[model samples]
Target: MIPTLILLGLVFGRWWRSSLMAAAVGWPVVLVATDVMSIEVGLLGASALATMNAAVGVVVHQMILRMTRQLRPAGSSRSGA
Candidate 1:
């Protein structure tokens, strides 16, 4: 579940979208599987964790993109010379 959320963040490359996706997938389970008090506490706790993880994934995705851009030769074509 954690990895899936992170992957969602990486794929989406946006924190809000990733969080929404996580909530869409997770909220129903949390709502159905827990008691009232647990639902309240768990939703908050899970939301925070999911947001943090998604943020981390977004950071990682940005870093990878930056690194790839840096590594590529400037104005280079796909065909080797």
Candidate 2:
């Protein structure tokens, strides 16, 4: 649930790569907290969390790349020379 929400936030914010990097850090923190707090039955394990982040990150990153266009290196032509 937390990962999903984070991913959603990333998609909505159009900051997918950053979000996934955030998630890569975020998910493990979540799992560790769960264990420390004795919480159980979460939506996903660590691997799932990473995969989800990657999948959503790809979509989100592409959209971000499309939307912002500022991410491209300055003065680099898109067309192959």
Clashes of each: 0, 0
CA RMSD per model (angstroms): 4.3, 7.3
What lDDT does candidate 2 reach at residue 15?
56
What TM-score, over all chains together, does every model reach?
0.60, 0.41
lDDT minimum window of 10 residues, candidate 2? 36-45
lDDT of 1 by residue, 27-57 (tens): 5466557653354556777777766777677
Q: Score each candidate by Cα lDDT.
A: 0.67, 0.60
The TM-score leader among the candidates is: 1
| Tens-digit per-residue lDDT, 3-46, candidate 2 | 67445545644655555666666666766777742344453465
Q: What is residue 78's positional error in candidate 1, in angstroms?
A: 8.6
